[model samples]
Target: MKIYPFLKNLSLVYVLALVVSCVGDPIEQPIGKFESGVLIINEGSFGANDGDIHHYDPISGDLQPNVFESANARPFAGLIQQVRVVDGLAYIVANTGKVEIVQAADFRSVGAVNDSKLKIPRDLQVIGQKLFISDYGPYDENWNNTESFVAVVNGLQGGAVHKQIPVPSRPEGMALIGSELWAACASGSQLVVINPATEEVARTVEVSAGSPHFFVQFGANWYVYAMDAERVYFHRINHSAYSISETISIPLANAIYNGNFTMGTNGDVYIITTSGASARVAKVSIETGVVLDAEYFVGSNFYGLGFDSSSNTLYVGDHAGWQGNGQVWKVGPSGSLIDSFQAGRGPSGFLFR
Candidate 1:
């Protein structure tokens, strides 16, 4: 299929074809043409111009590295922070100052958005047809954060920001519960509730005196991870009144606050923490706010954790310093390694198709 690339001064004139190349390495289950696999996002060294994406097939044990450059003939400006794959498109957010949009099915460059409002974009969330980007706005001459806002952009229109909605400083992870959007401010110490209809701050939930960073929604309850305090703040929201019903705090042990986590099928949270040498994954219960498994899964350089509900398999991203390349492990619930494959540097995030 043909896809268009993002250009600054020119229109969408450059077209590229989407291609998939199989690796030479052989393994147990080879992925078919349309089979599901894993996509690993590598946050390359800052300013090193090495950020790239890797694709792995568990059945085939095939690993494809730097699929972005392979498909588009150009590299991402490095420092790739996160990638969100939704609506058949992959949105790659890099500290290099833009969101690169690509066709998810074939990894072809579709378009991009690098508006002035996107200075230091951190995270992204898609609600319906709109895309919300959390930006840590530029700093002043004194090295103080000027202001942080969420740039609202049209997912269908592309190439420009639709509007800038002011929020707390250093906005990070964002969650959408019904019509309300909750954004965590890493530097503001609160969770800012935004009413998308009005594009304004509805209210703020004081998570900590320090900062509330990442967030995940499980059923009717919302969990916000406060790294500065080593606590996970849970809240019950009142949608009608646009307020929080109740808030509970759950403290964690030996939390290093530098990894990614995901929710299991049974509503439990699997959080990863890297220690002096080894890494561990713990399961936190959503109902009781208790640690179900203090050491559910353990490894070295376990940078990312994800749960696949279809096969009940857990995929762990191991960036064990393999010369800028990484490894992905398919582990059982009991922490037993089932399979392992190669990937890119710092495999910090995953997307299963």
Candidate 2:
């Protein structure tokens, strides 16, 4: 027989094509696409336990014990206070008056700044190529009579001190809103706007009791989130028109150490109240003081709050030491617990670029 080779092969090819179509999907659900973050908690070595820097995954909800641990990485043999992760470098603030740079990928010590260079650097704020470190100068062990310094350093220079610009008193938290460096004087309720070009204090935005912590600039407004002896104040942004027009309270007394908050794309504000007995993160419409939802971390240690606009994910770190292993949790748009991951000690605060 004249073997009908073409016809015999055609049937087999058609069957194979049908089998391929019945296979699984090519595009998998991006459940874990959201990048995880590191929590660098200063293990207070005094009477407090050594602070732990934890790594948390928003996808898996796992909290690793310690990411960066050691004496050199640990500035004072005390605690690792503040941290700024730029590119892949981790700039950690040591209460003993030094800032150490570690590999963000592995938390290995890359370099460090001495006391003479950085006098008790608190949280870090970056502008262009310069890093504006909140230098709350050291005094007696009782931590009295302190003045704030904004040490502008080269981002690439590991421990090199560029120039230390003096502010009013003990600047703890800082935010680079537009071109102005708003210094949050932790000891005093004052916001000094610094000019990065001249390193001069342009003006001061007066706050209530607590000083400004982490800030977010939204819609021609620089929200100066400050707190005093009793309450946390939200000073609306007015760059070209600088003033504290409207302010709001936390509904609870003393919202201190609340670094966990982020402004949503829709102009909504999300905040976590750790200082209060509530120990929860609440979402609210910034235009109104209405609470839409709140996430109560009753038993967990909570500290810093950050928002990622890309995936619309919210990150929170644990500051309490008793929690042992700290955490970095992922909150959904509705302020729901989506996922979590393991983290290092005290995962104080994190920045997502």
Candidate 3:
């Protein structure tokens, strides 16, 4: 068929458009300076109001100090306890009874939940639009956390306190399994389960090991770790029954009660243990329920533990006695020391993107 010059040009343009559409648009580069890096939560001196956030670029090996203050033009006013990134925002729970909402990508302040009911807020768990915060409620005359509760915020973005559900003393780490919200009561031997739909305590399971502080989920089961003076106990709870199915105890001379624990990519549990002044990472096999390595990664003053499943790297934080800048040790998958980088004061937790 004979074709005019204009018609031939139109056919070429249409083919070019079709090829471009099939390939799709180019992948956009991340614009935020703090995006695509590890965020280090610095507890900074308690009550000193020096709490800060540090950003470390794993690919570039560049550490950006005080990214929170740099982005907001003001220092974080409370002791940063933990950070949970949901959607595109970071909910920073602080010991100062406040949860600061910031842009996860840029570390910019967006909103905050400063309710009086958040007495010594320890951890945060977001279920849909609700934000559940575990708090070690106000202390009594003897300086005991006798009135611990979970403060529920109605909205995800710095909403007002919807209710405060009372629970055992010293509630710490929390998790949402199925439909129930399980909270670890660090001062007592109980794992309180709350029905998020009703925002009330559904039941409490007594953990004989006591001081259940953290949890790790592997496959269809959930494991919680507790510590006593002589041993560290790992209890596997049945997801449907909400009861402990198995208990694994690992003897230890001196075990720190910090809730620094994480699950490796292989479904093994890694916890921080102390030997005199040095800190060690203990690995526990999920299948064997035995101590795989009592000293997986050893270092000094290891205060926080986080595992990056993407790279199979373990990030251990060294508080340096709460002195100047802290350090984060990067351990390889084979339990070998890879590298260490300086972070903010009292590097307590990590958030990897």
Candidate 4:
């Protein structure tokens, strides 16, 4: 495997300048219409904590290392778990128990949405004009803290969290439909539905044959392709009834699972995982029930997955051990590893900036 060279080392002095002003071509200036850029979690606090977001340059496939584009985080945390961008603002969800709002242009702080009321935030999504954030509550696996909650902030209401709701158990990921919210509970193995307008528990839908972990909506159905350490489970959802659509065993003697994914324009779903103790990116054909292919990612672990909708450059977060170095891989549409750039630690969830 040929290791691609980085355009600018993190040690380069003009890297930040290069990030703002393009160095070549018949035309200069970063060539991306916030059409859908990526807000990546590059690094975090020393011990698996909070991270920052970058305006991922996918056309050229590079991580523009910025000095000030971090979450308006409070000094020290483990990792910035998830983030989503809409209307030129990056909504960064920090697992260190904070939600930050940063300007999309220069990546600076604007405001923050935190629930000192409810702690340990996990995933977030923007639907219509509202922001729905999921709280993982407590870390039962690590015995950290295991309660679960959800907060609905009306973006129309000045990003004001108008409602705070509770769920049956801890949430790993979530999906939204208009005014309805659906979250996957790690413990209950149920997708709990909530109506933020009424702050009421509406319904509970079971996902997969086993437990559901992550979800994304494509076309008319919401697809929850999840893993519970041993197997990969796929569920095809059409609003109400969802059944185990497919089940495939991952080829790993000891699989280190990371809960993040990206869906292609053609409805194919991608999950980043190891191919038997080796760093590889696995692709599944959503239309057909098969593990289509796997690409080498050149790292120990991956966090978030981002794809440039137009050019189809795949961006992956390189989280080696939740600390020290974080790198982002740039892979071509055909799963060819091309280049990479150093990112932050414990990077999870990415939004196209």
Best by lDDT: 3
Q: How would you encode candidate 1's per-residue C-alpha lDDT over 1-353 as one tens digit per residue?
A: 65445452234222221111234345586533323687778877654758898877767777888888988888877678888878777888886678898887777888888786788888888887788888888887876665888988886435789788887788888888667888888778778888877778888877533356777777766667665436555555565665656665556655656536787877677877666888888778777878788788787888877787777888888877546777788888776888888767777877778
Candidate 4 lDDT score at position 347 = 58
Report the Cα lDDT for residue 133, model 2.
79
- Tens digits of per-residue lDDT, candidate 3, 1-353, equal 88999999999999999999978978777667766878888888765768888888888898889888898998888899888888888999998889999998888888899877678999999998899999999989999999999999988788688899999999988999888999999887799999999998888898987579888777777888788877777888876887898987777535666667777876687778887788888887767767889899888898888788888999998889877778899999889999998888888778787
Tens-place lDDT per residue, model 4, 66-96, is 4234333344244566656667776667777
> Candidate 3: lDDT over CA atoms?
0.85
Q: Write the per-residue lDDT of candidate 2 for residues 1-353, one digit (tens) a residue.
A: 77598987998899888888777547664432112453535445445646556555544555454555542345234467777777767777776676767766666677766648666677777677777778777676776746667888775545577787877677877777777888777566677789988877898877754567656676666676765444455777566666667776544443436344667767666666654344776666656655555543333456666677878877766655545555567777666687766555555556553
Query: In candidate 3, how many Å is residue 192 off?
Result: 1.3
- lDDT for 319 (candidate 2): 50
Top candidate on TM-score is 3
Q: Rank the candidates by TM-score, best first.
A: 3, 1, 4, 2
Global CA lDDT of candidate 2, please? 0.64
Q: How much is the lDDT of residue 150 in candidate 4?
A: 83
Candidate 3 residues lying further than 4 Å off, grouped into runs, are 1-31
Q: Could you tell me how far off, in angstroms, the CA of residue 158 lies in candidate 2 after the best superposition?
A: 3.2
**C-alpha displacement of 200 in model 4, angstroms?**
0.9
- Steric overlap count per candidate: 4, 32, 0, 22
Instruction: Give candidate 4 regions above 4 Å deviation.
Output: 1-38, 46-50, 58-63, 66-78, 126-130, 139-146, 153-163, 240-256, 275-277, 295-299
Q: State which candidate, 3 or 4, has the greater TM-score.
A: 3
Against the hidden reference, what TM-scores do the models get? 0.82, 0.71, 0.90, 0.75
